[model samples]
Target: MNYNREDELKFRFNQFIISKVTGENKDYYSKLTIEDFVDIKNTLSNINNIITYKTTISFMDWLRDHFSYVDENYEVYLKDVLKVKPSVNGYDIMVTGKVNIVAEIKCNKPINNGFKYGSAQKNGIIKDIQGLLEGKTKVNFNPIHAYKFLVMYDFGEHSLKATEHLIKNIPSGYRGKVEIYNDKTQLKIDKVYVVFIK
Candidate 1:
């Protein structure tokens, strides 16, 4: 199985994500040679199905076991959640799944964000989840379908656990609670899908 596209895309995305996360606002594209991206794209165009599956699983497992989420909030404001976005979206990851089921990628690292002590920055994540939940609950989207939360963490298990706690406690107004996914249960995540790439 060959995962050249996946690998190349991730390599590019890593450069992009890290720059954004660390306030390195320089244009990364300017530094790249056409041959580099072409190679990655060609690799993806010829991606093998077996490689795709194996690579995806391996990537997820590495993420789960190797990194831990640390707190880092971005300056972007999410109006729906009425708070600044967390740094999770800017991590060295790229997510590709159905937009409807996929929420933002997050890091499960600890920080001194305003909301809670050493908790994952809750602003954007909560907002997106809540918005989706409200949309489903009010039949804005489709209430009949069970609402799900897909939290993709970068580093720590603590933030992952914190997300699980918040999700489990979604207000009574909504008919569903947040469901967390790991390697063991990721296959079961047919409802709402989230992919975290790094």
Candidate 2:
């Protein structure tokens, strides 16, 4: 059969939305908006590296699709576009050829029924932090700019808690250099940051 992934994704999104929105008055519709629905829908597709936003999800798309209110101060970096696709060229998103404005995207469900991140999940997140701080690519990373995002697909409260917990174990060496948010952190132009999306 000739398969069209975009059509399939749209079907899945519609089904998911229908299941979610069918129950009752949208006033209490999971307390989320239409944009939230689309974000979550695309997030699943993007994580799977499907049509719209792939694992190789680009700066253009990320900027256009997601909004970060990770902190009030982070307003400066919010939605600004980079001319090139940094993450596509490398493993994850980077604002420049150097280590300015890096990002790690995670589309994981909070493990063990949303209580927290499992051991493997924690380790994977740590690895992303590691790669962001120290680029795994052939080129050496020297963070010359600000902001590093650990973008988590908002999978409800459990996922939020899990993300907060992940920040606690940032391997000390990176503890000083980077500014990651559990609840909040002082925004800096010289440090990588974190943002959550769904």
lDDT of 1 at 189: 29
lDDT of each: 0.42, 0.57
lDDT of 1 at 2: 69
- Candidate 1 overall Cα lDDT vs. reference? 0.42
Residue 126 Cα positional deviation in candidate 1, in Å, after optimal superposition: 2.0
- lDDT tens digits, residue span 1-198, model 1: 767875686567767657756656555555668898798678666444333333334444444353232011111112222222322232122222222222334443445432232433555566555554444332334322332434454335545555556656655643244565556654332343343443
Model 1, residue 39: C-alpha shift (Å): 32
Q: Give the C-alpha miss distance for residue 61 in model 1, angstroms.
A: 12
lDDT of 2 by residue, 90-151 (tens): 44554542224667777677876775888888888777777666666654555445366666
* TM-score for each candidate, following the candidate numbering: 0.34, 0.52
